[model samples]
Target: MVLGAACATLATVAALRSGPAPHEDGSGDGGATGGPTAPQAGQALAVARQEFGLLSGGGWAQAWDLWTPTAQRAVPQAEFVRVNTECRPPVGVPYVIDASSVPDPTTVRVDWHRADTTGSATLSYRAGRWRFAPDARTLADYRPGADRLIQNRTAAGSCH
Candidate 1:
């Protein structure tokens, strides 16, 4: 199962690199790199790609490291490990972008699928970058009864 998940992760990364080049605002004056202005949607896509790379490379710590701070605050590493262990799907072609859009400059919504599971995640732009979380909403907004697509809410774990 781990092998399959790893494959999935790699496939996802490859898909990302093959897609359109990402554009971010070069707003950071004075030798700053990877600045904001990169649309929130683009930033979310990049984060997802990095997460997949971490998983594919047997770098669970790195993969977890890619999660948003908000996500980290919401769910810890132990739970992340547990959920990933249970949810890792079988190896298949990496999930396509399915669809992506920014509801607002600060929020990005992406619909993604792998084999049997399909879901969407909401990301927020912070520090001029994007981070994934449970839609940046109230617990009630994330409740299964409230949103059907929020299949998982596990956050990124620690680097170590």
Candidate 2:
């Protein structure tokens, strides 16, 4: 399973890299000058990709480390691992980051799709780094023993 996940991560990375060449500042503009938010958007997208890679590779602790402080406070590390491990998302499924928008100077919204699942996540720039900031719904759904989100994902064929 770990091997499969690693392969998937590699494939995902390859797909992303092959899609477009980013500017020196990390903006996916092929050296074209983007707006003020372009660099920050790129940073948030990188952080989001790293978090998802960690999750897909079963690096739960590392993935949790990328969560915002508020998200960490809402869901304990053990509970997060337990829930994810119990039902685990499918391995080797490539995810596509569709779009990213900067809602504010400090916040970015990323839209992504994996298999049949489409979702969004918010990332906040804090203390000079970007972190996943789970919304209220996500935090609630990730609560200990909560299975609704898992069930939905499983039904959608995104998780097993």
Candidate 3:
């Protein structure tokens, strides 16, 4: 009986040390919350923050690099830089991450706002890393007239 108890204790310790059990989909349960693990969420949020930081800091090319390959294919680099440059946000404007959620094991959806502008972006985990994935509407709006659209969306002259 003592031997059996020792073995059981060892097994319990091992399980505890092994971290949270993965769900059937092979994603960590994040301890009863039913979403991406904390590390996964942090990584995704870090990507979102970094992308926005780069954009706000006028590192447009670097910010564009954070985009998922699929999003990059949908929106060319030059066009993205051009539109954003034309409607750059004011210096020191703060963007708040409103909320984030796991849409899937490999995707995080982040809702954010800055002054009068609000948006949602998807971060995809692929190739062992996270990347920003703009939605279809965003891709469509990043065209030649995007400056006017962005200015109109934000308080007049706020994003100019």
Candidate 4:
């Protein structure tokens, strides 16, 4: 009974946290849908927060787990670990939740700042939830010097 109550309470909290989008009315940069679903926005924020938290704390494996299925499929576990470990080593902590922008009802962009630099990510609404689905450009060209032409590169562990 106690466990069930706790679960119910948590669910309620989650629902409450997922309030309506800034532009809940049928018009705004938020998109074609009437508005971004509350659950989607909350889920995206929760996932982003958790991932950033783990990454900032240097828990590479745990942070990798926070990634969406798509991200996991795109980058292998080893590669994800390597990337986060290398790029976010000094990311300090994911202490700050920078402002969020709903470019379209289907997309929300969240930016994070470390000690001296910043990183931004976008989440898209899919199946009634906010998910990480960056554009082809972002996925293929994360690094500044990465190849711009990433059409059909065949590699055993290629993210593109």
Candidate 5:
């Protein structure tokens, strides 16, 4: 009885942590309906928060994975890691994330304010799930003499 009860509790916790059951198509949508579901929308915000936590925790490579393909290409892996780690938010420890709005079923905006600074990031639905700034671009002349064609789009701002 004790063993069964423990197993049941663990299962319940796992289920709660995992959130909604994704569709058979694995879109995390309500399944067969059409657009993004409540669970999927909640998951998007969760992903956005996870990305911020990853960055604050110094998981540079993992955080890099959160960027869109365009953003990834705009900045080289080494350069991205260097710049981000160098410019990490001054927020001391136990970084906080406060999600404000989901502009649409497919997008979310989360905020962070600390150490006398405030910033935010936006995530959008992609092939199947949420991603940070699925259309990030670099600042003008961010790369000098690299001959890289600049993409002009909303940049994933600081600490994103």
Candidate 6:
């Protein structure tokens, strides 16, 4: 029985592998269009806006939930929230998601202008939703491009 089960599993795996790969779901997540569709791009922008809303409202933990898996791995949940709170000012000022560029189905670059300053973030898509994907260690370990994306949200500062 065990041998038979193993053979069946092997056959199933072979059959699945012989078919189309998983990335070709045709929703444009990773299909022939080579990038996200217009609607998917718009969805990414909406998610970005939602994140900003959460940040400005002092929803630290909720805001952290918007981060990509990779980013979240760099810090624990409480640490992520604490870092963000300690870096940026309170979010009540007028801010515009001035630009959202979708270079591929999996990635979107978002820019926002708030008061006299501008900030940006690169978001990655998975499970039909966008997550903020900033590459960094601690708050200040940012290269120039990353510096612009989060608009220095991780810069050295006091929460109040």
Best lDDT among the predictions, by candidate number? 2
TM-score of each: 0.52, 0.70, 0.66, 0.52, 0.56, 0.59
Clashing pairs in 2: none
lDDT of 2 by residue, 107-157 (tens): 999888987779999998654456789889988888987877689878876
Give the range where candidate 3 is weakest over 10 consecutive residues by summed lDDT: 8-17
Clashing residue pairs, candidate 3? none
Write model 6 residue lDDT over 45-152, tens digit each, in one string: 655665666565566686677776666676566765545555656566545788777788789898888677688888776644556776455333433223342455
Model 4 residue 2 lDDT?
36
Give the worst 10-residue stretch by lDDT in candidate 6. Answer: 13-22
Tell me, by TM-score, which candidate is best.
2
- Deviation from native of the Cα of residue 54 in model 6, angstroms: 0.8
- True lDDT of residue 37, candidate 4: 43
The local distance difference test score of each candidate is 0.53, 0.73, 0.70, 0.54, 0.55, 0.58
RMSD of 1: 9.3
User: The CA-based lDDT of model 3 is what?
Assistant: 0.70
Candidate 5 stretches greater than 4 Å from native = 1-39, 85-92, 134-160
Model 3 per-residue lDDT at 121: 86
Candidate 1 residues lying further than 4 Å off, grouped into runs, are: 1-40, 52-59, 86-88, 91-93, 135-160
Expressed as tens digits, the lDDT of each residue in 10-80 for candidate 3 is: 35434433555555553445356555444477677777777766665577787788788788888889988
State in Å the error of residue 51, model 5: 1.3
Residue-level lDDT for 130 in candidate 2: 68
- Per-residue lDDT of 10-113 in model 4, one digit per residue for the tens? 46445633544344442323435565444456567666665566556666676555445566576566765655444444444334667787787677788877
- Angstrom error of the Cα, residue 17, model 2: value is 22
Task: Name model 2 segments beyond 4 Å from true.
Answer: 1-39, 153-160
